[model samples]
Target: MKKSLRFTKISVLLVAAISMSLTACGSTGPKGGAAPVQAGDESKLFGLSKTETPDELYEKAKKEGKVVVYSPSARANDAKKTFEAKYPGITVEVFKLKSNDLMDKLIKEQDAGLFNADVIITKEVSGAVGEEMVKPGRVYKYLPEDIAPNVDEPFRTKDGYANYLEMRTLYYNTEAYKSAPVSSWWDLTTPEWTGKVYLVDPLSSPAFMDLFTGMVVNSDDMKKAYKDKFGKEIELHGTENAGYEFIKRLRENKPVVLKGSGDVLDAIGKAGTKSQAVGVAVSGDERKIEDDGLKVAPIYDIKPKTSVPDAGYVYMAQKAPHEYAGKLFIRWMMGEKDGKGAGVEPFNELGSWVPRSDVKSKNAIPYEKLNMWTYEAKGFYTNSAKVRDFWIKLK
Candidate 1:
């Protein structure tokens, strides 16, 4: 009986050893199907051997350090705080300037190899600025799904190198045109509206540059029509002599050309009392003017002096000081959290304009239908030196 019991115990030990071996084999994955090594676990998230989200990218960038941004718009600090809160470890710095000054600064920094600019936030024309500052492949590609809903395909590049996220439209004095009878673009150049027009300096302001460029392109046909009607040229610049002809016309006409957008708005708000300047002003700024109880409106017609297409863009620098941080900031700025539909305050809406769309504005020209209007910042800024030379003389 003792011998039989010992044999039974040996049999049980053999079976237990075989079971343990099977369990160990099951835990080992096949070579290619093996899960990745996560920060804490061996199981890969999203079932991929390797793939990272913008959030994950943000975390990686935070560990790497800071981001420096250059923009021509206001409220940079607010944007920085929102980013810092989302990414607890990284730091963001902003350098804000007027659009033209921003371009000059970028060129100077690049030539000196200072390497500070990480990201850029400026008007759509600023894309041309990005084209100048960074090499072709160096700019990052990122387009968040949230911003996608508001943005159309034409304004966005396929690999996301360039995009138009926001815009500024043209505004008019509401008190002067009580019911806004000026429905079409031609109305601006009418005899009734003569000497009532005001324009900001197109040379210095990128927003104004967009406005004027649109006018020049859209007005070619209009210029011809007017020339035939008047039996001579309408003399937009002037029917005067030589070099300062255009300059003289702009100045002697008394445009009230001011230094910045605020000046234009300030002048428009008090147009009734302040020499009656029914000028061209920023649509966004006009909203602010009206919020203060001043009467103002925007005219989106396709006339010689029609409102221009304004688009805002964001970019990353190639020689960014905080490389990873720059990537993190781009993801933050262009992500769902800061985009249009997620209950987040959009820069577009705050500026009181539509994001890029096919929808037409009642008193404004929709980008789709304006065959004459075009926003070619690359053409203008690439030749900005030449344009500025002419502009200085004109001013």
Candidate 2:
């Protein structure tokens, strides 16, 4: 009865929110191109119209007066400080949430027609809730058009509403498995590496979840190849029974699940050369792992265990109280370094792919550009609920 009542309340809330957003005006339109401000020209940025420059859109960002963000990373505070320091007048509110929570909140808010957030930096929840929400291109668009062009095609929308930027890379402790032949992502699932494997819970870490989702969705070729090699069908998607059996076997591999990527990183850090657990890690954390003198390397094998590109994106709420601020934030996000985030090089990071080409890549894997892996974007986004339920059943 309690569960039923709770559900009823949630339904009421959702209905109220959706009605609010639908009534808001100009919430679902696109913006025209801004005049190009070459890198290093802050003057043009100051005088341009909101149509031409993110700066013009948010000339009062400092006065309007706060920017709220929801991110999958625990480092939200650090990122906020970096941005606030660069733009002194604007106060930043940061929420470090699991990807699931990020998606739940975003979707619920969108459904309710509330625009409480100015910007959102999330992990790969795009798979789970992307389809239920607004189309990224129809609602929010890309920034720094020239620069964004260099980001990988898979990471962004063709219309440029969503732009995927590099955030981090995955790393394994090299010294821990020095004697063993461990060079690829598939190696972690092997018997020899069984007890030694550690990973983040998919519900908690968007980066790790997206990475794994990428693996599952991209394993189509492998499934076909397995069937071809054995001269029989390798059932990747079969009746419910077959899928459940596969998932059960996957769980039997006995991965040590932590709440977040940082937990795995902590264990790696403490272990030094003697670390027994090898884990999936953020590129930034991996650099720290290596810098601490522990031998760690990023596994970038493109076949079988092909890596997925890490990307960042933002969306505008359909019913935003601060609609102008939300659009301004998206434009600001796309602005070159001089415009946003403390010259953090605007959208390019290590081991990830952005749309632009000339900008230096931080941690992109070679041969990754090859479409050897069959990544199902549509499948992941639409079927995430089923996948999450399955993962829970296995647990």
**Candidate-wise lDDT, in order:** 0.48, 0.48
What TM-score should be assigned to candidate 2?
0.65
In the order shown, the candidates' Cα RMSDs to the true structure are 20.6, 8.1
lDDT of 2 by residue, 1-395 (tens): 11111223354446435433221112232232123334554323221222434465467564577767777654446545555665666666767766557667765675575656655665445343333333221123333433444344543333223333433234565666564345444445457767777777877544555555554555554454344444676554442533343344446789787777667766654654567666766554545654555565655543344445454545554434444455555544444533333333434444434344444446544323533333344556644455566677677
TM-score, cand. 1: 0.65
Q: For candidate 2, what's the RMSD?
A: 8.1
lDDT of 1: 0.48
